[model samples]
Target chain A: MNVLRAIYNFIFELGDTALLFLKALYWSFRPPYRWRELFKQMEKFGVSSVSVVFITSLFTGMVLALETYTGLKKFNAESVIGSIVAVSMFRELGPVLTALVVTGRAGSAMAAELGTMRVTEQIDAMYTMAVDPIHYLVVPRLITGVTMLPVLTVISDLLGVIGGYFVSIVLLKINSHTYIRQMLNHTDLHDLYSGLVKAAVFGLLISLICCYKGLSTKGGAEGVGRSTTQAVVISSVVVLVADYFLTAFMF
Target chain B: MVEETVIQVINLYKSFGKQQVLKGVSFSVKKGELFYIIGKSGEGKSVLLKHIVGLITPDKGKVLIEGMDIHQATGVDALKLRRKIGMVFQYGALFDSMTVYENIAFPLREHFSLSEKEIAEIVKEKLALVELEGIERKMPSELSGGMRKRVALARALALNPGILLYDEPTTGLDPLLTEEIDNLIKDTRDKTGVTSVVVSHDIWSVIKFADRVAYLANGRIEFIGTPEEMLETDNQMLKRFICARLEDKLMTSLFNACRSRGSCTS
Candidate 1:
C-alpha cells in the first residue's frame, strides 16, 4: 500500500509538473516579456555553464579512451579504438554524461536561486510589477539550455575522439593514421545528429524540471534546499532514462 | 460618508488544508482612504491583502475592485486590473539582482513603451517622492532596511496605481524610521490620492495613520471603526491585542510553543 501510494504521488506530481511547463511556455511569448532578463538568464545558464561542461567533457574523454583502448587491445582490435571511442562518445556517452554533470552543477543551482527568490517574495514582486516570472526566469533558461547543450555535446565528442587518438598513438603505440581512418569509417552524420538531438532533449528536461521545482518551492530556506536536491535528482534520472529510449530509436 | 468605494470584499473565506485563515471576512475601503487592518500575527491580515491584489483567491465569496469581480476576470482583464493595484511586501521584496534604479524602473519599463529619457524622468520623480533620488545606482544589499522599504515604495508608486497595498510597511524598524515610513505613506496618499490598504500589527502606526481601522481576530474581523472608536472599545480581545497586555503576550507565546511542538510531533 505504501509503494502504491508513492507511485500514485509520483504520477500526480509528474502531471502537475507537465502543466507548469506548458504554462511557462505559454507565458514566454506573452506581452510584458522581459528581454533583458531573458538575456541575463542566458548568460547565467549558458555562458556560465561552458567552463564546467568543457572541463568535464575533456576529462571524461580521456578516461573513456584509456578504458576502451585497454579492453579493445586485449582482443588485438586496437585499430578499431577510434571508432569505439567516437561512436560511444557521440552516440551514447557524451550527451548523457554531460547532462548528468550539468544537472549537478547548473540545474541544482538554478533551482536554489529561484527557490530563494520565491520564498523571499521577489517573484511575487515581479508579478505585481506586471513582469511575468515565467518569462523573466524560465524561458531564457529554456532557450539557452536548448541551444547550448548541442554545442557542448559536439565539443565533448571532439575531445573524446582526440583523447582516444592520443592514447592510440602515444600510449598504446597504435598508428595514429590507422586510428583516425577507423574512426572516420565507422562514425557518420547520423551519429552526430542523434547526439545533438539527445543533447537538446536533455537540455529541455533539465531546465524545465529545475525551474518547475524552484517556482513551486514553498516554506523557506529548508524548502529551497529540498527543491534543489529534487531538481538535480529528477533531472539526472530523466536524462538517463530519456537517453536509453533516444539511443534505441536512433539505432 | 459620500466617498466612492474603491475596494469591496464580501464574505471572503480562505483556508490552508484544514486550518482556516480567513472566515467569512468582509470589508470595503473608500477612495483615498488609508485603511489599516491590524491583528496579532497569524490572524490573516496578509491573506486578506493578497486577495485584494488577486495573488491568492478566496475559497468562497467575492473580491471586487472598481466594480469588477477579480477572480472571474480573464488574463487580459486581470493584468489590467493588477496594473491599477500596487503592493509593497512586508520584506520590501526588492529584486536582489537589480540596482535601486532598475528596481524602481521595473514597472515603468514593463507597463509603458517609454523612451529612456521618459523612463529616467519617471524613475527620478518616484525616487524623489520617496527621498531616495541619489542612491539609484546602489544594489538592494548596499542599502539599509529602511532605505530598501522606501525604494520599494518608490517602485509601488511608479505606475501611479489607483490602489496601494502595504504589508507591514514599518515592521522591524526603529521608532524614527517607523515615523518616517508613516510620513511617507501620508505623503504618498496626499499626492496620488491612491486608496491605501495597510496590513500591520503596529499599534502606533494604526493610531497615527488609519482613517478606518479593522481589528482581525480568530480569522474574522472582530471590530471595524475609527481609531477613536477602537481606543474606546470595551472588547477584551481587542483591548488585550491593541494594548499588548501581559496576558495577550503569554497567550501568543503559548500558541507559538504549541504550533512548534505540533510540527515536531508530526
Candidate 2:
C-alpha cells in the first residue's frame, strides 16, 4: 500500500512538473519577457560556476589518464591515453560531472531562494501584484539552465582535454606529438555535440525539478531546507538516470 | 448606510484535509468602509480575508468583488480584477533581496512602461504618505517591526489599489505602535477612499478604528455589528473574549472608559 501511494504521488507530481515546464516555455516568448532575469541567471549558473566545473573536469580527466596509464604502459600502448581521456571527457564525463557540480551549486540556490520566498508569501505577493510568479521567476531560470549548461560543458571539455594532455605528456613522459595526434585522430565533432545535447537536457531537468520543488514548498524554514536538499538530490539522480537513455539515443 | 458592496462572500467553505477552516462563512464589506474581521488566532480570519483578494479559492462558494465571481472568472479577466486589490501580509512579505525603494517600484516595473524618474517619484510619495520619509535604500531586515509594516502599507498603497486587505496588521507591535498603525489605517482610507478589510484580534484597534466588526469563531461568523454593538452583545464567545481582554491591567481602565462611553451593560 505504501509503495503504491509513493508511485501514485510520483506520477502525479511528474505530470504537474511537465505542465509547469510547458507553461514556462509558453510564457518565455510572450510580451513582458524577462530577458534581464534570464541573463542574470545565465551569469549565476554559467559564469559563476566555471571555477567548480573547471576543477572537477580537470581532476576527473587527470585521474582517468593516470588510471589508464598503468594498464596501457604494461601493454606498451601509453601513447593513446590522451585519446581515451579526451573522448571520455568530451562524450560523457564532462557534461555529467559539470551538471552534478551545478546541481549542488546553482540548482540548490534556486530552490532555497524560491522556497524562502514561498514560505514568506513573496510569491503570493507577486500574484496579487498582477505578476505571474512562474513567468517572472521560473521561466528565466529554466531558459538560463538550458542554454548555460551546454556552454559550461564546452568549457569543461576544453579544460578537461588540456588536463589530460598535461598528465599524458608532462607527467607520464609520453611523447607530446603522439598524445596530441592520437587525441585529434580519435575524437570527433559528433562526440562534442552529443555531450552538449545531454548537457542541455540535464539543465532543463535540474531547473524544472528545483523550481517545482521550491514552488510547491510548504511548512516554513524547515520546509525550505527540505526543498533545497531534495532539489539537489532529485536533480542529480534524474540527470544520471537520463544520461543512459540520452547516450543510447545518441548512438 | 447607503454604501454599495465592494466585496461579498456567500456560503464560503474551505478545509485542509480533515481540518475545516471556514464553514459556510458569509460576509460583505461596503464600499469605502473600514471593516474589521476579528477572531482568535488560527480560526481562519486570514483565510476569509484572502478570499476577498482572490488569493485562496473556497471549497464551495462565491467570492464577488464588484459582482465579478473570482473563482468562476476567466484567467485574464480575473487577473484584471485582481489588479485593483492590494494586500499587506501579516509579516509584510517584502522582497528580501530588493531595497525599500525597489520593492515599492516592483509592481510598477512589472506592469507599466514608466521611467526610472517616475518610479522614483511615486516611491518617494508613497514613503511620505506612510510617514516613512527617507530610508529608501535600506533593506527590510534593517527596519523595525512597525517600520516594516508601515513600509509594507506604503508598498500596498503604491498601486493606488481600490481595495486594501490587511492580515493581522497589529499582531506583534507594541501598544503605541499598534495605535499608530490603526490611525494610519484609518487615515489611509480617508486619504485614498480605498475600501479596507483588516483581519485582526487586537482589542484596541477594533475599538478605535472598526466601522463594522465581524466576529469569526469555530469556522463561522458568530457576530457582526458596529463596535458599540460588539461591546453590548451578549454572545458567549465574544463576551468571553471581551472579558479576557478587559482583564488586562493597562486596558481595564481604557475598557471601563470605553464601556461608560458606549452601551455596554455587561
Candidate 3:
C-alpha cells in the first residue's frame, strides 16, 4: 500500500509539474504582461549570480584540469589537456555545475519566497484579487529561467576555460600557446551551444519544480522549509540525471 | 434595498483524507447584509469562506453567487466571479516584497488600468477608509498586528468589491483592537453596502455586529437567526458553545439572567 501510494504521489507530482510548466509557458506571451517582474527576476537569477557562478566554474575547471593531467600524462598526451578541459567544460560541466550552484542560491530563494507566500496565504490574496498566480508569479520566473540560464552558462563556460588555462600553463607547465591552440582547435560552436541548450532546459526544470513546490506547500512555516529544501535537492538531482541524457542526445 | 440573496450555498460537503470538514452545510447571505458564521475552532468556517471564492470546491452541492455556480465555473468565469469578492485573511497575508502602498495598490494595479496617480489616490482613500494614514512607504513587517489587519482590509477594498470575506479578523488582536476591527467591519459594511461574511469564533463580535448569525456544528448550521435570538435560544450545543464566551460577561448586568441559571445555551 505504501508503495502504491508512493507511485501515485510521484505521478501526481509529475503531472502537476508539467501542467505548471505549460501554463507558465502559455502566460509568457499573454497580455497584461509583467515586464517589470520579468526583468526583476532576470537580474535576481542571472545577473546577481554571476560572481558565484564565476567562482564555482573557475574552480571546477581547475580541478578538472588537475585530475585529467596526471591521467593524460601517462600516455604522453598532456598537450591535449586544454582540449579535453575545454570540451568537457563547454559540453557538460559548465551548464550542469552552474545550475547546481543556482539551485542552491537563486532557485532555493525562489522556492522559499513562493513557499512563504503559499503558507502565509499571499498567493490566495492574489487569487482573491482575480489575478492568476500562475500568470503573475510563475510566468516572470519562467521567463527569467529560460533567458538567464544561457547567459549564466556562457559566463561559466568562459570562466571555466580561463581557469583551465591557468592550471594548464602556470601550474602544469603545459605552455600557454599550446594550451590556447589545442583548446581553440578542439572546441566547436556546437559544444558551447549544446551546453547552453542544456542550461535552458535545466533552467526551466528548476524554476518549474521550485514553483510547484512553492505553490503546493501546505503545512505553514515547516512546510515552507520542507519545500525550499525539496526544491534544491530535487532540482540538483534532475540536473545531474538530465545531464547524462542531454549529453548523449547533443553529441 | 438589501433584500436579494447574493450568495446561496446548498448541502455543501467536503472532506480531506479520512476527516470530513464540512458535511451538508447550507446557508445564504443577502446583499448588503452583515452575516456571521460562528462555530468552534476547526469547524471549517474558513473552508466555507474559501468555497465562495472558488478556492475550494465541495464534493457535493454548489455555491451560487449572483446565479453563477462558483464550483462549476470555468477558469475565466471563476476569475470573473471572484473579482466581485475580496477576502481579508486572518494574518493579513500582505505581500512581503512590496510596501504597504504597493500591497494595497497590487489588486488595483492588476485588475484596473488606472494611472499611477489615480492608483495612489485610491490607495490614499483606502488608507483613510481603514483609518491608517501615512504609513504606506513601510513594508508589511513594519506594521503591528492591528495595523496589518487594517492594511489587509484596505487592500481587500481596493477594487471596490461588492462582497467582503473576513476570516477570523480579530483572532490575534487584543480587546481594544478587536473592538476596533469589529467597528471597522461594521463601518465598512455600512459605508460600502457590500455583503459581508465573517467567519469567527468571537461571540462578542457576533453579538455586537451580526445582522444574522449561523451557528455551525458538526458541519451543519444548526441555528440561524439574529444574535439576540441566538442568545435567547435553548439549544444545548449552542448553549454549550456560548457558555464558554458568556463566562466573562456573566457578572455583567446584560448576562445576569443567563448567569443566574448557570446553564446559558446549554
lDDT of each: 0.85, 0.89, 0.89
What lDDT tens digits, residue by residue, belong to model 3 across residues A205-242? 89889889989998988999999999999999998998
Candidate 1 residue-wise lDDT at B73: 86
Model 3's TM-score against the true structure: 0.95
Chain A of candidate 1 gets a TM-score of 0.93
Model 2: TM-score for chain B: 0.92
Best by lDDT: 2
lDDT string for model 3 (B201-258, tens) is: 9877776778999998898899999877887777888887876755635624445453
* Best-matching candidate per DockQ: 3
Provide the interface RMSD of candidate 2 in angstroms, 1 decimal place: 0.8
Q: Docking quality tier of candidate 3?
A: high
* Residues B221-251 of candidate 1: C-alpha lDDT, one tens digit per residue: 9999987788678888898776675565664
TM-score of 2: 0.96
Over 4 Å off, model 3: B245-266
